[model samples]
Every structure is written in C-alpha cells, then in structure tokens.
Target: MGKLGGEMKALAKHCGGSHKTVNDCIHIVQRFDHHLLALNVHIQRVAQIKVRHIESYIHERLAQGIGKRTLQNEMASLRAVLQQAGRKQVAEHEWLTNKSLGLAGASRSGTRQAITPEHYHHVLETARMKDPGLAAALELARLMGLRSQEAVQSVQWIWGMGTGVGGMWRRCMGKFDSWLRASSGWSRLPPFTVSERLGGGGKYQAALPSPLQSKPESDRTNVEINERTCPE
Candidate 1:
C-alpha cells in the first residue's frame, strides 16, 4: 500500500462496522485523499479535512459526471471517517450534505437491459478474433452469470478441484446442465439463484441458464472444450 492507503487504513481502524464496511470506508477516504493530492492540497491526516475540501471534492466529482447515487455513498463514507476523527461538526455540516451538494436522492430503479442474442454473438465473435482465451472467459461469465473476477477465479477453482481444493466447479456445472435440460428457452431465463452458504464474500454459486444452453450438444461440447483448452 502507498502512503495514502496506509493513512486511510489507520483511520479506518477507528471505524465500527463489518470488515467489508471498514474496507469500503478506507477506499473512499483514500480516493478523497488522492483527489486532494491531485489538487496540490497536501492533507496528510484526517484532522486536516474541512468542509471546504469535501465541497470542492463534490463539485469536482459532479463536474466529472459522477452519478448522484455514487456521490451519496461517497459522502456517507466520508461522514463516517470524519466523525471518527472527532470532526462531527464538519462531518454534519450543511454544506457537506447530499441535499446541499445538489445530489438528488439515490433511486433503486432497475434500468439494465438484458443482452440480446445478436449483440452477444457479435461481441463473442469479435472477442474470439482478438483472443480465444478472452472469448472463453466471456462465455463463462455469461453462462454462469459471474463477474469477470469471479469467472477467472472459478476457472482457477475448476483446475484445482482434484487437489483437495473444492467441488464448486462440479456442482456449478451439474446445476447448469440440469437447468439446460429443464428450461424451455434461454431468451428470457430467470436470474441465477445465488447460494450464500457456498458463496462467501459475494461470489456467485449456481450457474444460470443461458442462450448457449439451448444450443446442440455438439456446440455445448465445443464451449466446454474451449474452456478446458484455453490458456490461463
């Protein structure tokens, strides 16, 4: 870790929360510190943080097109850090509030659209042309409803299965094959059911039904073969 990271980590130790929450607070504060550094404001400690600094940070982020929801979360994290530093007045200052910063209420409305088959195929082909390994990883992420890091880690887990690692690969693939046989179509399949017991630290467990599952056995075999043969 760099100087800013170390400082943020020390400040985060004063915070009270779960491990993830503390780490998240540290990350946000580190970002703020980096931003201050960029602006030629050398704030080496949290005690140096002022309402003006936060207001300036907010305005800079807003100008950079940061979303209201994200800004709200950032402000909350900063507030926690500031409060821990015994700067309650500065933390609760009106100028630092979301409303005062012109940050609207965060919305929970779902706006994501599922990837269409045509688009998926097009991107897959393009990725294949660039790198077969990347194409395979992309397929794994899509079929398993995994984030990029999860897909990579899952592949590693699969390779390490017989070495007393775990059975996540076998279980996920078995569930995927079963879902393939039972589902009518893959154009609008339900979201994958995440198993919290099996998935620690927000990693997904079960594989979801995907359009590739609707393909012929030969095509499915090709994907599996690609996954196995692709260079790590």
Candidate 2:
C-alpha cells in the first residue's frame, strides 16, 4: 500500500474499532503516526514494528499521565485491532509483549525522586498503627510494590478459604522484593509494578477473609487464591 493508503486504512480501523470517534482516533493515530515518522517507518508497515518502536510510543504516551494499565490496555486494543487488519506482528513486538526497551519512570534514571528508606518505613509504621488495610497497602506499595489500584482491587474472595487479601499482599511483596533496586520517582521502567501514585486514592483495604499466608517461594508471581493476572 502507498503511504496515504496505509494511513487511511489504519485510521479507518482505529476510528471504527478504537475509541469510537474520528476526533479521538485522529489524535491517537496522529500520535502513532508521529512516532512512526520519527522512527522512519510508515503506517502500512506498522506491522513490522519491533519492541523498540513500542518503547518509544509508550514513553510518549506515559509522559501524558496515562496509567500503566491503561497504556497496556490501549496497546492491547491497538494490537488486536492491528491484528484484525493483519498487523498482529506489530503488537507482538511491542515493549509490553516482548519486554525489550528497558524504559524507566521515577527510577534511577527517571525524573521523579525515589522514595527514601525513612519514608518507606514511615508509611509502613503509620499504617501498622492506624489501618490494617493501609498497612497491608504500604507493604504492597513500599515492600510488595503493588500499584495503588492493584492493591485496592486485590480485595476479593478466595477459593476454599475466603478473601484474597493475603493473595494480593503476597503478590505485591514478591514483586517489590524482586526489583531490589529503587524506582525512579515515576519512570515507566521495565518489569512494571502495580502502584497508584502517592496521595492518590490515599486509602484502600480489605479484611482478611481467612488466615493470611505468604505465597510459596517457588510461586514467585504469587499465583494463589483470588490472584488474577491482569488480562493482557
């Protein structure tokens, strides 16, 4: 396909199947187009995009305050839509899918300041004194490194037992510990964690449905009762 033709087709698919408005589609597609242009790629050949291209696109979008999950969803939707257009290869090579392009937000290289040991300890201790949810959340955030909403949404029912607080806590802590290195204040770095920004929602919790148990060491992803991996 010619340059204009490819743009037209991608735009058509994006508008009809994407956000449902030409205006929004234009913005999204234009952003996509701009990124491709910067990378010296064309719309028709977007299916040939590699993980590096996706990293650039994600870094651009993440700069706009789009949440990591939301960005993941957008990319996922885009990938599916592209696949329907026989462009699944584009999605397959994305940073999200391939885990290349080690971008960082609020990390050692990000613009945001890393949380200090004192601050981390403070949040943990304060939560311990006041709210168990807050305390559990702190462990998830400061220790387990769960995103705010993940920690919040993690409150659900478990099998054979009761709820999924332990399930959530275990997962959160496991992730936090895995990346021993400090996160740049807000960099969209690799091995993304589930975290809500500080002072955002500021409060979330769930009661222990049963006796909370730490996830098995072997089960690193903390696959346990009530722990659902976010749909990709």
Candidate 3:
C-alpha cells in the first residue's frame, strides 16, 4: 500500500474513545502526507526513510519556496512521529544531520522590536480601545520579554510579593495586568494550559527560579494595591 494508505490504516486503528492518543498522533502525522504524496515518497514503514530521503524532502520544500521556519517544523514533526513509533536514531540519519537546515537561529533575528516604555503605553492604549485582552498581552510581552505567541493565552493572574514568576509563554490571546507591586519576594505563580506554544510542555517546574531584588527591604515597607492594573 502507498504511504497514505498506511497512514489511513494507522488512523483507522487509532481512532475512537480509547485511541485518543493514537488519533492525535495520526493527526500530527497526516500533515506531512500531502507533501509526501507530492514527492511520491511512501510513509509506510518508517524504516524506509533513509536520511537521504529526509534531505530530499527538505531540498524539495526549499526549491519550491517554502520558508525555512516552516520547513524546520515540518521536519521536526516528522521526526517526532517516527520516534513515537519507537524508531530510534531518527535524527541520526546522515541526511538529517544538518539539524537547522542552514537556517539562522530563530531568535537571532526577526523577532518583533521589544516594546519600549512609550510604545508600550501606546500599544496598550490602542489595545484597550480595541481589545483589552489583546492589550494585556502586549503588556505581558513587554514586561516579561515574552514573545507575542506566549502572551495572548494567559487567562488567570498570579501575583507575588517580590520578583515575578517565569515560565515558557506564547500564543498571547488576551489582556489582563491586575496585580499590585507592593512587597519583595519571588512568587510562585499558578499554571495553565493551551495549544502548544511553539516550544512548550516542559516539566512545568519553577525551573528558572526568580532572583530576589537587591533593593533594601526596609524601604519597601508599604503595600500598594491597584484594581485598575490589568492582569497579564
């Protein structure tokens, strides 16, 4: 059978209540079927995927004018699917060795300009006038140095006495910055979930512990609360 047929069988066997995981896995795997079929490469039996095969897939995408980032994700997804099937050394394939596909580091360039204080307020004002949730996301992105992708999906507000919380963030969907900056202590924020944040799903630990501020404790005595502040 062709690769699509094989994937179809996989999807069929994987569907239904007990097979939710299999269905999800198939969904992720099927995204590549269109491209694979176009190249006449069969995806049946992951063992057939020589490293050179993956290289050709990448080269084909580049030749057809696909962006490096999209191609990178495509390869990553394929690698994951194969690995999930218990195939080891997925990346060990010699053709797949050019890990980054000669592309520049994602964060090295093209990230949007960080919002300066002035621009930050402007964007906030605009977002408030148009959409408060979106404005709040802008604020979080600015204060937290989070990518826009990480900002919008934050729904609840987690406050602390001193240094703020930290975690992987993206897919910013709404605006809400509503905590008072009153005391000084690293705070443990609550956790929430959403669609994969490009790069998310770590252990959800306080992995990067917040550093306590250097300001004198005596001077930071008063507690000031503001209801007007948005939650981000």
TM-score between model 3 and native: 0.45
Compare the candidates by TM-score and give the number of the best one.
Answer: 1
* lDDT for each residue of candidate 2 in 39-154, tens digit (9 for 90 to 100): 66764554455556667787877788776655654565555545556665555663466235333232233456878888877877888888877776555454334467544544
What lDDT, from 0 to 1, does candidate 3 have? 0.48
Distance from true location, Cα of 87 in model 3, Å: 3.7
TM-score of candidate 1 against the unseen true structure: 0.58
Worst 10 residues of 1 by lDDT: 180-189
List per-prediction Cα lDDT, in the order shown.
0.64, 0.48, 0.48
Q: Look at candidate 1 and tell me the lDDT of residue 6.
A: 67
- Best-fitting candidate, measured by lDDT? 1
Residue 23, candidate 3: C-alpha displacement in angstroms = 15
Off by over 4 Å in 1: 1-5, 10-27, 83-89, 105-108, 161-232
Off by over 4 Å in 3: 1-30, 40-42, 66-86, 99-113, 144-150, 156-232
Residue-wise C-alpha lDDT for candidate 1, range 93-191, written one tens digit per residue: 978778899997678697899999899989999998999767867877676565575555554554334422233344344333332111111111223
Q: Name the candidate, 2 or 3, with the larger TM-score value.
A: 3
